[model samples]
Target chain A: MSSEAMVVGVVGGGQLARMLHQAAISLGVRVVVLDPDAGCSAALAGAERFDGTWTSAEDLVAFSRSGVDVVTFDHELTDPADLRVLERESPVPVRPGPATKLLAQDKLHARTTFAARGLPVPAFAEVATAEDVAAFAGEHGWPVVLKARRGGYDGRGVWILADRDAAATVLADAEGIPGFLVEELVDLAAEVSVMVARRPSGERRAWPTFVTTQVDGICTEVILGGDAGPAGLAERARELALDLAEQAGLTGVMAVELFVTRDGELRINELACRPHNSGHVTMDSCVTDQFEQHLRAVLDLPLGAPDPLVDAAVMVNVLGGPDPWDREGLTDALAVEDATLHLYGKGHRPGRKLGHVNAVGATVEQARTRARAVADALGSP
Target chain B: MSSEAMVVGVVGGGQLARMLHQAAISLGVRVVVLDPDAGCSAALAGAERFDGTWTSAEDLVAFSRSGVDVVTFDHELTDPADLRVLERESPVPVRPGPATKLLAQDKLHARTTFAARGLPVPAFAEVATAEDVAAFAGEHGWPVVLKARRGGYDGRGVWILADRDAAATVLADAEGIPGFLVEELVDLAAEVSVMVARRPSGERRAWPTFVTTQVDGICTEVILGGDAGPAGLAERARELALDLAEQAGLTGVMAVELFVTRDGELRINELACRPHNSGHVTMDSCVTDQFEQHLRAVLDLPLGAPDPLVDAAVMVNVLGGPDPWDREGLTDALAVEDATLHLYGKGHRPGRKLGHVNAVGATVEQARTRARAVADALGSP
Candidate 1:
């Protein structure tokens, strides 16, 4: 690796990659983004662009040859097998190597691995047919959550089935019964997430646990320094996240989403091994943001302090609304003294994550109110 | 101008422009940098590069044609006449217009204007020959400071002459004796600066005053919020900066450097109508950094709060050492947990500004110590 100028090759040019590219500039690092679209968000942010898809080995190899020191991913959609091949063929190192990346790509694999390690996770069973789902539901309860093992995001690959008939209908519509998993649906009071950064040397650090609110399976807002749940929930969530990072041998930022059940137990819901939406508040509220931390970890640099710079911070997503774009009210949003707006350079589409607003205040409620106001201003009228 | 995505055209691509581009990403503003060097620091950070010198009117016009909404500058090295021509020719508006820009480009003009407005300034006189210097020294006392009226930075274009013979020697060495100004050297106890952002609408905001320490006329460290002088010093500095911004019709970030006398009086020393090194600490220590404020002011967006995020912050510049580059000790520097490093992507040269390290702590002493340690580790062996 050239220490003069470290070049990181990211496999996707989404908002995560775009933010990483922005953070890289301060560290004197260069980011080369590999995406099929030439005008992806990262490209607009000035990352060196390589026209290629994540699944194409030839494109990945070309990107690696273009003077990149390390290869990483913005998302976990790339096949682990393809990454392994690239790792063996490319000159640069692939961070969060195939083994670690696969842990996040496949839901069944992650659940089974965590269970084997005696982690607190939802009761889960692999599903091949409607009978498998029915049997799992019979043991767990009347309602169960079904999730595809891979390639699903937002609300795309998850479903809550209350009975065998519902499972049968889902199964009948599937093509050749795609790989899936069934889990016992726990009674949730709130959802929280902990973000942790782990280097290849086994060094790990985590941010304070923060509460997240999702609407229609989409992250609508994140609240930090708020009443997350029962006492000790934050500590327990942090411990769980750190342990997972170590177990997975993660070499970058990892977000551990947890379900805070009504019974006060913490259950692992999902894992994302990249800069996450839940941690977006860190951009304005933390001493060192998650994107910069991810870059430092993947580069094996010493970790920065993750201390909060404010008493409370809240982030609200600016999901694309009915209008193509609503920038007229941007001035109004900017009127919120502490509201910091970030817009992903993307064409507008209903429900798309166009941007987000962050606000810091003495209390989480105040911060959230200000952030939501800015988000509302930026949204379609 | 498309509010959907504002494109700001910057006239220089140095470290200031590089930082502005980094800040622009979070604000969803695209920066088109017009610099002669294709590999300037801002270009390396992913800003759109328009190859052209600051003096080339054609280049400026071409840059404005590339879908820019407003034009700004990273430095005051541009010829004011060219800016005036570009203002008349280009479709986009030129911020800080040519009139405001001229106030910063010519030191004599700035001093004259400020002095005419009853600002507190050292006694000064323009010099055309050694006789002029001797005459000014007769009134101001020995060891008067002589400064070139334009294109001077760091220690360049500045000299101190103790007598007529010393002044005669300097004038003899000068190439055609550039336009110079003589000022009485003040018995200064410390140097402090206040950074303020102004819009064309006459709205102005200033950050907390900071103390700057310089060696050989180049700033080496900036300390914020601790022993910056008397309690009212900050308020006075802010008032002075705001008044200057208003009187000069300044737009964007303006830094007013003041000399704090041993007897507790503040005197204006210099003015920079862009992000200054004195405000670099704001990147890691303030709620909203100066670079972001510059972009906001130039874009006419509502200014953000400039509250300090910590009790104190210290920023130490990483002046280039004997070595062309220093990477071996980066890991050592990274050992300082709260020390954030910012390296401009530039080829190293002796005494050049390569980067800066910032640290925040409970006290300015603690932050300065940490920041200085990191900077030392990154310096020459």
Candidate 2:
């Protein structure tokens, strides 16, 4: 009912920020994107572009003075120290603050904090050398997982080692990568993610737990009403995500990615302090999508219902392919009735995310089949 | 499916253009708005602003050369003669062309065309003086409706003259007004509208018929599955709308406003070349909202399905109130679950359209009740 429009400054201008910009129009809000790339995807969507990077405190200060009511990040690459400096120097409110964002930016910090809070997470230890990894593997067993504590994504920062000799080789190969951590590699059954939005006023809501399929360390597909994994796993995932949101004082959308072991134990894998790819299905199937919810959370507005609009829905990401970018099969893909396609307006690169397609149907299998077909069509030459 | 992003040039920067800009993001298209007002609602949504008016041929030429693939109008105020000149000078294709747009811009032309085509329209005649109005009234009876040929919106260009004396006074006061047409006032019933999207390639689709409630000639609310007027009136309205779209060679969304007579006969009332207020409910209830459909039609892409996602939906317009714009009751309005609010980022003036609220429910009455409550809250002091 208010005619007052709020300007939200986002630190990154990727697809998440692009979607947030789109969602803000209906809410009468303005999004100012601060990305070094002049042609970032969000900027293409008409976001007020400010040429800046995550590490530039001077740029953040200038953006704060440019009338942004609140500042949030599209990615967790911003250094907590830089954010703190911005918070102290600028008048704009930094949502989810540095402390909360750090839990997502640093894997070791999240694992340690969740472990200390009596939450279920993989057994992990800081790995300074091959011996540290060997020691951890000796206690946990062979085939342990090694991960870089920061700046690792899409399986790039992680390695699975079979023995102490393999650990030494991996450690040697990862010479320049900083902040290594070793963890037990559990016998996994499946992977699932839960998205939660929390406002500064403490109001929080969680979307339904959904299953995610990963290929080469990147999410390829997500299905709602996921394969009824361990009897109570879904409920537990929702509870854990909500509990973490409350404990972390999260002031926007956060996703908790979890691994379901063969023995039915649920363990937290990682956290994303922004809208995650696993929730893209919500765009077409839920009463309120995650991007809109993220804006509401940061703006401290009342959360909307997260109920599903259809019986089942699935989303498939269209990764860049070996062939050059072309819409050769787009007409055929669009012929798959009821399937919604969203192109990110980005240049093509092998294995890079180009866009996503969502399909809702009477059953999950039907939705997944239609969604995959459309995504395959989009990726084909 | 082409990777080439299409740039759409819109001639107005009002709420319709704002919504179109929002819709373009998902389609991976770009919208360039040409409006003289830098602070127009669409410009605030991040549309590329052209900083010019529709009447300026130089601006139109520059916009076309700036890489806009197609040009469209959000309002009917653009003179057809000006558009003709621009079309001859610019390479960009102007959708609906000048001829189709003229039908909506000039009432006399539309009435004459539809009548010549043997369409069901009220008996009407051109009136240039008080004697002409008196002569038309002598034949069609008293209490006839008079409408300006151009530049009228809401209730501004229309008047109901009761007798010869009133007609004389009205014509005397109408000194410099443009062309006028006097028509027989139809007997009471209900008013409804049907929206259709037509592509240049001959593809056409229509949404379900709905009823509109008007206050002082401005739409206040629209309800889907309108009052069960005649047994088959809805079907007939759809047929007529589609027929008109094809007959006019329409290349975008066109709304056919119709009057349902007490005898179950449908009569043409007016036409809107762009997204109409009566179709706002489609944003929440239909598979494809009108704005997206408009873009699809103009681009010659496959039109999305118009099936309803819910059993019924209602949309209520939020008119500016006596009090200054404030968010005093926004929280309360948002508390109504499942109701979505869309605010146009425009400065408020009394009687101006500020926003709209939409609600979906099991029945039209139930949805209308909730939508009206939210709209009332938004307009309250």
Candidate 3:
């Protein structure tokens, strides 16, 4: 509350941190980002750079020594053990703490916690053996989703088992892993995500639930302000997300991914403890960009208003295709009226989240169509 | 062009350079900035920092020695001799080249050039002595505008002469300055500026001219995409600017300041070779931001369209007020539904350009009103 500038320290120097750096700079706040590479845009955007792994205790200690007001992350892979150490030794605040972050970091734990909280989750069970998977399928019916309990992102660690034979093969391969979660494969009409920001002071706010489209389990596009569900469902989803944040002891931006079935039933799918790809559209379409709000929440400042600035906004991820990443045709892409492109300074890897493009339009479908066209022009699959 | 990355060097570290850096990054290009400070935002934006004076030949040589693909500036204050040396030795493209930059760098040269080109400009003469000022005013006018030929900006280095007596006082006090221009002071109705981008390939584009309001010679606000003159006059201004660019062998974004007299005649007032303050609203209001277009033009990329995205947009500068700058009530400014605030990370100084706020509305006046309210809330004078 004082007139002095606030310094926020972010862990991991990925696109999320790069955006947070941009947001902090806009508000005249300084950010210190500790990343594994110095070439990341986060470092380029005036964040005091310290190169090291986030999992290293010594590096975290050095990062905490910067006298930052708060510490957050661009990725959830931050070592929980190191965070626990930081909470005790560092003077700066750590949002979401280790407990809430663990819920989202580990798939098995997230399911258990949501189930215990009496939330609307798909029918699920944690399995360690083929028999356990078969038994769960026998009870919940066929065609279930098998997921790794940790470190899966962008459609990397999930598989659908339509029958007992496939379930046997998947479970046999999951022997050494912590465990796998089996969930009913609900027939979904669409997927949506509600991004919310919460502070330790108990203030919470959520952006409008946007209908998300995914291909092969990787989020491909987001349609803002859509009528994907029944009337008033967005508000309900926000309430659920806020409640979940509180229950999970979250203290920053957290995205709750949800499924809307053919019957209009809403189900909580998963959660991300930091800025989500689904919220990337906010950089161009929201009154208060989500990254800025995240910094505000984590720094214990008053939460900003979460209002969509446009009637419809669609964000399409620029995932790398089989072809080499040439960044060619960007001139044509930039020629799109009202198009905003954010390229993460990440290396080219097939199906990797290289960047995203957001387009604002009068309708979600129109925005989505434009966004997809731009993404395709940028070599998206 | 080869797909390999290339570097562009900028000679200043102001907000224009900062925005240009952002634009360059989107095109997969890099920039090296030579600012006088180490911790400036442009330096942090991956601009390899070389801190020194812009007018120093040694500094310019050091900056030019880096083999940067091109050398440009956010502001046109480079010493002419140093620029000429760099052009001969390094062969890096220098936009607005040295010849056009003088039209802005030296008021006397600009006036004479405007007259020679048969463009509409105020009646003016180079005043080496107070007698010359008196003669010029006696011949064409009573009140006159006296401006120092170089090294003045943002209301500085300009004086209004009411009569021979006032002119005598300024000339007596401004002894040995050697370079001053006396101009016929037109009874102005409104002020406007046209922002145009030109490529080395002879391609040129211009954004709509907008009426600007000034306080104490510093621009207070801009009303974008509004008619500042008749449609025919506006088109003429754009053509004249493009013609001027071609004549001067200039390549990059250029802003032309003009006066629309009560008689509906438009006259050239001044020229800015870099991104001007009047173009700030283009960051959020235009299809291709002026800063981005400047990069595209200088890099020889095909320029994007310069269409206005909104019906009207207003940009209000956050001028430092009389009261010591306070961070109080900034949240209130940030809370405005349609206002976008951009704060430069600089220590406050009286009458300094810290940042600006932009707003869009159905009408120019409405947007201007909202922008001013936000700037006022941030303690602008």
Candidate 4:
């Protein structure tokens, strides 16, 4: 806002932070990272890192002392009360304050807010008892989806209740966690996500939503410049995301996941208030990469053009298999022409997200063709 | 020769290493950097750094321990004897070796090599005595160029003998330096540099030669994809550089600095056997940047397409001024649309290489127009 390079203090030590660091370098800004781990990916930029957690008030005060221009996150699990307190005494601004971040952090709150706004969403209700789950499933005709309200990711807190019997089994697993939400399982044609950016000044820009393919409930690939539904569906989804961001007072990057049902209607599925994997392909395919756009939005800089630079771009997640000790496997995958491999610098474990690979070419099929080859190399025994 | 990523070990820590680092990232190859300074630009890539003197065998041995696929340099001033000894125990290979590197390191050797090969070079002789200088000056007329055989840069190791009295004053500066060479000064109309890359398999690729302008002997700007002179001049410059590379057995990026004289003849002014600053504009303008080409050649990877992406590109060097500070002024300059800035992360000093800014657009004049604004911002008092 002051026409100076804004210093962003990012909390979390992961690949997201690492990429944000790279984007900040190009903009001539410094990123200060707060992570307890020394080998965090963001440390490669040589950004100042305080060894601590986001919930530590001492750590927050130390971060505040670093002369940061703003405070943001690589992941959206920050304590709302902590953020609320920090905003009162912070040296810099905190984005998506307690009131708004809750809409993303708490799944039940997000569903309620969406339904309250008359947005098209699957019929869902907060479930605290077996009767609540039974009634919702009975009304929805069966096989309802139950999800934890918080602290869930990568399909971990979600379960599909085949019937009342299956609901009881999953209820034992959801034991002490916050209240679960029961939603009618819409017979969806495909799952897609639209990534959008918004400045505090009310400016919004959307990237072309892409159909996503998943494996074992984890996102496996993202194909840009395509929506399984009609062209208008993508635009409609983008409009919904923008309206939701404005209503929720969301700043920076926000992702709206959508499901296109058999009737061709777009319904809100889930939401992430920070940069999402669905937008990773933008790093190579878009004129202005999404991570950089997030930094610009958070810093309140003028938004940049978000047009696609290629016809289509496909991104495939590189998951770690058992005994994932091979480096050449990844290198061999990269040898394919026009393929870019990004390793997340994480130790490998089965089903863990080590990194992702992106390919851009003449068509979605062409990009996906190359992307499959890269994914095979990662999963190769 | 294998399809494995060839590990290139580059010696010296400067802006060249920084660009080379960026190039290596695109190729998915690891570069081991040996620089005495911890803050060397190439260190940004997490390139293994052995911070020690060029003459230290311990440092050389440390570099050889992990085994490099090929050892090259960002600076050609490395001691030839030391390099030759290290090659024996090298884990992988060293490109050019001591013999070829010396040609670029010593002006006397370079001139003799060119003369013996019957290549076009200015009339010159080693000035061991005043008679040698006087005879050459008498035959060539006034305004001969005097250059030290080693250890000089940015016009510091060379002098212009405008007249007999001026020659006497310049001769004193070259006194302590070894083997000074005197050459007839050509009435140069323009300066251009030809950048060519040679592979171990005798494959060679040449980038479009561009006109280079210098201020105070430091490269100030590059006009990429421009017709520096006539078509014939560019062809001749390319041919001369290729011939020089083949003759010297150079197997990496070679830059030939040429002078187009009033008579329309091209003469080799100097040569650099590394990623030259004159090619920096290629990073933003060329389809395959010169650094990527250098990495390809050194790694023996399949060369990439080297066509120009934009019609024109201009590179403006950010030389340090009397003040030590961040590039706030330079950032302000990039407020112009379509400008890309590359900072080397070096400490500020008077007359030091800090970083560079580039602009690529539809026309040479347009690119230069925008580039000058950024450069002016960086160098403004």
Chain B structural similarity (TM-score) per candidate: 0.96, 0.97, 0.95, 0.93
Q: Which candidate achieves the best lDDT against the true structure?
A: 1
Which has the higher DockQ value, candidate number 1 or candidate number 3? Answer: 1
Clashing pairs in 3: none
Where model 3 places Cα greater than 4 Å from the true spot, the runs are: A1-5, A44-46, A200-203, A225-239, A242-250, A302-306, A309-311, A322-332, A335-337, A361-374, B1-4, B44-46, B175-178, B225-249, B322-327, B361-370
Interface RMSD of each: 2.9, 2.2, 4.2, 6.6
Per residue, candidate 3 scores C-alpha lDDT tens digits across A114-173 of: 888788989988887777888998898888898998888888789998888897887667
Candidate 2, A1-381: lDDT as tens digits: 345688899989999999999989988888999999988999988888888887888888787777888998889888777888988988877887888998898899999999999999999999988899889988989889999988888888888988888878877877667688999998889999999999998999999998998887888889887674868889998998999999999999998999999988799999999998998888877778898889888988888778777778899998777864444466556657667888787877777788898887778888888888887777631
User: What does candidate 1's lDDT look like per residue over B1-381, in tens digits?
Assistant: 113678899999999999999999888899989998988989989999888878888888888888898899998888777888898998987887888877777778878988898899889988888999999988879999988888888877889888999888877887853488889999998999999999876788888999899888988889888676777887988898898898878889988999999888999998888898999999998878999999989988888888887898999998777765444577778778778989898887767788898898889889988998887887732
lDDT (Cα) of model 4: 0.74
Per-residue lDDT of A358 in model 3: 86
Residue-level lDDT of model 2, residues B198-241, one tens digit each, is 99989899999988887888988888866749788899999999
The candidates score, on chain A by TM-score, as follows 0.97, 0.97, 0.94, 0.95
The TM-score obtained by model 2 is 0.95
| Residue pairs whose backbone atoms clash in candidate 2 | A327-B1
> Per-residue lDDT tens digits of candidate 1, residues A1-381?
113688899999999999999989988999989999988999989998888999888888888788898999899888877888888888977887888888878899999999998988999999978899999988888799988888878877888998999888887777743599999998999999999999887789999999999887888889889888888989999998999898888999999999999999999999998889998999988878999999989888888889888899999998777765444577778778777888888887877888888899998888988998887776732
Which segments of candidate 2 are over 4 A away from where they belong? A1-4, A230-232, B1-4, B138-140, B225-228
TM-score, predicted candidate 3 vs. hidden true structure: 0.91
Evaluate every candidate with DockQ and list the scores: 0.57, 0.52, 0.31, 0.17
